[model samples]
Target: MSEHYEDDKSRAAKASFYHAYFSLKNILIGSYIVLSILVISIFAVVTSKVTEQIITEKENRAVINSLRNIDDRITLKLDNYGTVMNSLAYSESTQTLLKQASELSNQRQLELVNEVYYRMNEVNVTNTEINAIQLMDLSGKKYTLNNGNYYMEGLMDNYFESPLYDQVRSLNGGLFIDYSGAYSRDTNNLTLYRTINELRGTRPIGVIAMSIKKQALGSILFQDSDLPLTSLIDISGITVIDAQKELQGTESAISFNSFTDIASSFQTPLYGDNYFITYLKNKHYDYTLVNRAPIGSIYQDVAFIKKVNFYLILFNLLVVVIIAVFLSRTLVKPINELIGLMNRVRQGNLNIKMTNPPLNEIGILANNFNEMVTTLRNSVPLRKEQLIGKLLLGRTADSGLLQQAKELGLPAFDSAHGVAVVEINDRSNIDASGVSIDDVEILLQSELAAIHSSALLHILDARRVIMIVHGEDEDIVPYLHKMLNEQKNIPVTIGVGRFYASAEHIHESYLEALDALNYKHLFDRNGMIYINDIQAYVYSYEQLDVLEDGIVHAVKYMKEEELLSMIDKLFITFKEQFVSKEAMNRTIVNTYLKIFKLMSDRGIDLFGSEQSNIQVPSINNIHLHAGAHELKREFAAFLQSATRLIEERREKRMNETIAGAIEIIQSRYADNDLSAGNIAKELHISENYFSKLFKHETGVNFSQYVTTVRMEAAEKLLRQTGNKIGEIALQVGYNDANYFSLCFKGAFGVSPGKYREKQGN
Candidate 1:
């Protein structure tokens, strides 16, 4: 009985432990709650300490950056204004106007003022913030230019007598006044005053004043409404700008306590409220920028941050508790579901799916599994298509193809079969028509089914699809035409080959189909071409040689008419001789090659046409044409362009040659041997060609032109000096003095001596 009680107690303990182990969801939630509380408590303590420091540092950095930004903008704007003033002071026009200010007449001084007024107008227009520009000479006479009805009244007539003038004059730089009260309506006016001294000497010439609206300075301040106060104070403790316009020209509220640094931040009281102050001294101007904020706002931000951090920590702990429970339920469930899915896939069930899967690694595994199954499901048909492609290429054995075709539900092979290639004439046309290769294939399959013919279709590429049809007597051309008529939007060309007696020769029919398709240029035949219907012809090499020579000769000499006629004759000859397509291709290629060779041999730069931007047609462009008519048209256009280029080249060369001949004539007219023939020999041209070309270009025969040049020289000699006719004759390229006199008389209608005597008279 004692041993029985011990066994029962041991069983009870075992059952309790197993019961606790089974309730894992509750255990996990409880553990997470405890851990999150401890972690959040520790985190809160550490974060509170660090956050204050970080917030303080960040606020300081942001305030400093704002100060720098304001400083830079003010400095840049002020410097620009200063530069404009300097330009005016040192300008030649300004200097001249000022120097002659006293001695000039009324009109002259008015003219000078107009010059300076135009300069002032430009500055005022560009810097619309400036109110007025006033120029005062040494005698206190004022010249002012204003824009948009902004004129300064003389409320401060004693401005020159004030200490401000003395202050600006004492220093070499400009001085800024807070409010000049120059405008009667607006008392808050900021003016820049400087003495305009002679740039070359130190003598003071004039005082120039520029007035700006106070709001312009206010606009440059950092626009933060939270700040209680911000001000720009001069070194003399006067406020130049205040956010409140009433404080302008008043003494600053907060004292610096004599901190002599460029920048300082401290806590101070302003108007009974404790405030934090940040100040930066401007490097370019005699001003200090000061910003102040209430001390309560800073502590409020810190308190708000601490409160937000505590709430955030509590919210995170709650999320961790919820997540622990959720993961305890969901993590194992998805993994198990994934394992089951994988098993089903392993069992050859590719249609299984996991719905609303958890977003974790298991979800990725499930998606990949689905994709893998889909690929496996599609691989059979893909493999069958590949096998058919291989069969058409003669890369697969007939036995293997038959077995795979049977298993893959492909059309069975037959003893007599033929391959037809249906090529889309233009892929763009198909895209424009909203039809695809699949649509065309389905149409073809439906037509084949309608005709009760067994066939297999595979899209070879984007533009072409190949069909292997069973039976020797089945004619697929009519069905292809039917499909073409059904789909009027997509244009197609069908090349059907003769049926073979064995499957092994299917690739031969494929090749033959492609061959028939290429004959679209010769016999389009309404886009339905058959191998057996195409007629082969023998070409004579001698005939091709004659045609090629004619074409090349026309292109070489740039004869457009002859080239067109030759191109026409080429096709005509091909038709008359019934030349094969291959021979026709060879003929066209050989013609282009020979023309290109001629261009190379003659050093003709195809792109040397400066008069026209039309590029010479590339020789490779010939291969782009697929039809006889288009090829003929493009070839004609190409040859025409070539003719124009060659003509331009020849014209340029002829002009250069004529110019060279004229240069030789000018330099060698005194040689006495500068005949057209001698010059032509030097220019590497025949005398007749040179003479005719020269007359055509210069509107004069070579001999007459030469004689004209000589007579003009002789006439100059007679008028300018006392040289005799014989000496001038030798100087002007005439060996015989008597002949020179006769030639000169013919040119001038007077003998050389008579001309000289007439000129002397």
Candidate 2:
């Protein structure tokens, strides 16, 4: 009984497997599930290999981007420091106080010192990172201004002979940065020093030093919170800043002997951990930023990502299997229906239609099929017009057009015919007349029916109408003229071409008509022009040459009135001389090109305000104009703009020259030979022109301004310094004390001694 039961179960299982193999839905589901598993397995293996490489590459890019950002932050902070130091060193108040500090009385000196302290305090309050500001005079006296961190040691007795002074003097009045701290000896503080010089001379007046808190800079430099180590290192591998306070001013933990460029990365072992190191050199400073991360930690992150990816892949595989099963059921029914409908269409059943369909790709397909059938039904009517247009354009064979025309129940173009091209003078006129080109085409066809009775009209575009008439040129021209006279209110111009014997040659006449229509701009109003009737004149290229010169000269000198008048004269000349359209266009285009070239040669960009390189205008672009009037209008506007640009350039040049002359006068006013002529020669300009320009721009003559500057300096020295009359005179650019007294008397209405006495000297 057991053997019999086993044989029956095996037979039943074999029959079930055969049924599943023959079933389409079951077979599709099974095949998809198996294929999905195979594809997913292969993809997971490949992705595992590729993800590691991609992670490494992404890590490299992230490190590089981090270094770049840190570099920018550090440089910006340093520039802010430089700006503060510059303001303190060159301020007029600071300069005057420092230069006159030693000469003032005990009480007056105390008052000036209070004023200087107030200004420096304001600067420190504005820049919270500043620790303190120190000033050392040429006499070895030092003054300190504290923000909030106030710790001061007395000034060195022999400051002039100290190493700090030597370093400051070595830079020749330029700024000096002491990264190791000179003022406070604190590793957290960096000092910036500047040698204060007289405004015009190279004599050192004093030294100004400012100490900045490194803790303030650390806020921006140590932004890599995830990294194990981040530090700012100098070229000598000394750590200037580090995330750890104790590490500051110590040697960098990573060696940089292999780095040769501004940015570099490598793998190194540090403190028994394999670290990936990336360092970027600051372009404006003597520092390199080093970032170190452990290789084991990076792989740990990659391993976690792999675990998450595996789970996601497993979940996605389940969803894909479910989707495959559902799509197989939903897809087969609509696809089968689509195939049946397409079969009917292929068998020439244009009447079949699909009833309501579900909103999906299948529905879109059904709707498209219905639309395509309707379009085929309507296409027959349009083919006749399409063929006719092609025939007029010579794009279709004449024989092919004849056969199609007979089938569409239209007249065959088998006889002599000529083509006329019609266009509105301006599209703007169409709007002004409250008429569309379609209405105009209808009116034109009605007028043509009365003259030729069998003419066909086609609108090529919004601006043009093409007409085909089966007749001789003599007959066609008269009919076109009559049509033009009847449609006088339409604002349309027509050009008639000579007749050809057959339709194949119709485009030849069409082309000639287009050429003839170009001359219609010469007429005062809309009318008919004939190809044979156009008279060619000896339009002078020499005249165009003269016009170009006139345009350039007018623009160069900013003569707007002359530019407009010349353009008007050229158009009038074209009309009076009966110049052919080609010759007229040539003259205008040549003149335009020459004008732009002239601006370009002078290093002027007419279109772009900030463009330095001259861009040549394209010749082909000129032909895009609708008609002569548009070209003429644009030409006039271009000339006006050119004149405006020239005016702006001249004004800018004059301002720059005046500013340069002022700078030179202020710097050299103490020289005895610093006259207007000498300053003008130094600036590489003519003296007479420079004097005139200076007066025009400054509202004062060059010599008068120079004298004013010198007198002001003399007044300051007389009041501030205890000097002899001869010494003060020479200091203020006066050679002799007697002459200085006379000029000073003229300037202040008092002698030098009297002026000093008036000031309570």
Candidate 3:
């Protein structure tokens, strides 16, 4: 009882320990999971925002510095061009040429043109970025030199409607720069127009318009940029010059008028969705130097960074998983092993040595556990014997006796108890093997151990082992009876007492066992003789004569099993509850006298049949037997002969029964829990006897037959059903799909799922 109680306690403890262990494991893994997600999210968001900030700030600064530098240099160049144009326009040579070109002879006009052209060439030497220098008069006459060519294109077709003519016509001083295309066809050029005035009267004479190739000016301003195009846009939003010629005729995507009012550089969308712009405005000229590029091209650097970050995160995640697994195993393995060792100790394996102690708290615990087990090993078994011995003898427990018993794995329950005594018969008289009965105790302990049950067995004397039991009773007494009866040394018998409430009443049960043990003399064979079993068979002496005619009638019909059952009842009454050995022998002889007289009245021959060993020993021989076992052997031989006659009656139906058993196996094969013993019970047959006939008729054991039937069914289901493999496995009575797959593969060389796929279903 104490053993079982302690077992339950240990089981509960183990359950709680594993609960904590698994919970802690999940928490640690979950922490890593949550932490990894948080880290990745935060890292990605922070990196993206910071990169955007840096890119914006850096791009802004670069646009400002590049535009400002270009603005300063271009402004200075324009001012220089203004100074040179003024110097040329007020020259005495220019007034002389303009005045003589219309008044002089053809020869003098040609000479005057040569003189003006040479003057213009000198101005070009000082300002090489000038593309074409032209002079136009109020009378529509024109003088032009392009790219410092001596053979210049003489142009001045119409000056009245040109922006250069109108803007310069209003300027009394300084240059008027026109970024708008000089002509619709010449879109890549812009003109700076300055009006030439009479120094004497301040009257405008002609407009000197310079058509500068915007590329030359842009090259000077934007030499440092990697951007594809940098250009100057006029107040009218027309692009003057671009490094890439594609935008030469295009209008500025951004409005220069909006930006010209600002004191600093700024950015805006340009060309709609295709481009972005950063611009610096020259308010003096209303010519903005703008840097524009495609958005995708600009963000290329950032995209590369994002890809690198993603790979880095993947590498870090892999490291985290590896470390998580390593740490979990390192921490959990030792504790799991310690738990394993502790369970072994709980299960009464005192010799098990706990191994691989770690160097921390668990190590200290391991050392303590080893010391504790060393102490328990020396005392537990001996103390258990003493504890049961004192209880069964009805001795009052001394102070701390209960505590000591509990420490040795006994529970201190106050109720529900019983006892059983098993006696090993003396083998000296049997001429059997010489093995000592005490040596069998080791084998009994293992056979009696249960999943969570407890009982204590003690050897009380040379031939008796007493078991003090508590809690539930199932097959303990019966299994012990079987083990004892099958012992090869000699006949052994068991006697079980009735269950009694109250722990202290176990002594009463112990006494009852002793009384029941004395009834063993009636059995004449190894068997269990429960007190209740004997009570069930109790009868009066007057009943013996009445039973004799019935017994003889059963024997005449060869009802062997029925007749033997009656004898068992009569003997239990005669020996266990009522008569002494001598009185029992007298009653037994008188019972046989009635049986023989009945046989005589029927005129049946008492001699044995030649077909059977149906011989009755003389009454003197039965009376002279030394023990119940030898006397019962004589009766058993007589019963065997009668059983042969019954077998003759059964021979005709033997094959039919065997075939019926096969049908039951086939029909029940789909039940995953089916077994041979349960099937025989349903068929109303003894399992032990049914097993032999099943094997003989089927060429396989019952379990093997069931497996074969299930396997065939599983194949049919796998081929025909559209169900999933795991679902089909369950339908065919396999609880585990993987095991079913393995078995199927072993039989058919293909897994169920693969086989179904092959059928194209």
Assess every candidate by TM-score. 0.35, 0.35, 0.34
Query: Candidate 1: global Cα-lDDT?
Result: 0.71
What's model 2's TM-score? 0.35
Off by over 4 Å in 1: 1-50, 125-127, 173-187, 222-228, 305-761
lDDT score at residue 739, model 3, on the 0-100 scale: 86
Q: How well does candidate 1 score on lDDT at residue 405? A: 68
Worst 10-residue lDDT window, candidate 1: 177-186
**By lDDT, is 2 or 3 better?**
2
lDDT by residue (1-761, candidate 1, tens digit) is 99999999999999998888757886788778777877876666666676566555545544655666667667656755665565567555677667777887889877877787777666442456777777777777777766557878652357676766777788554545434343223446677777787754568888777777767767878464433477888777777678777887777887855447788777787889998788888744677888877878756656875785677566676664664577567656776787788787665566677888777545655555565566557666656666776677564453467766665666556578888888887667679878888888888778777877667888865678898887743666666765585546567878888788766788788878877887777665347778887677666686677668767767765667878887998887766555665677777878767766776565566555643565445655555566677667766776677667666665665578887887887788888767999988998999899888998876579987788777767766876788777898899988899998888777666787776665443
Q: What stretches of model 2 exceed 4 Å from their correct place?
A: 1-50, 125-128, 154-174, 182-184, 201-203, 223-228, 304-761
Per-candidate clashes, comma-separated: 0, 0, 5
CA shift at 445, candidate 2, in angstroms? 62
Q: Quick one: how many clashes does candidate 1 have? A: 0
Q: Give each model's whole-structure lDDT.
A: 0.71, 0.70, 0.65
The candidate 2 region of ten consecutive residues with least summed lDDT is: 150-159
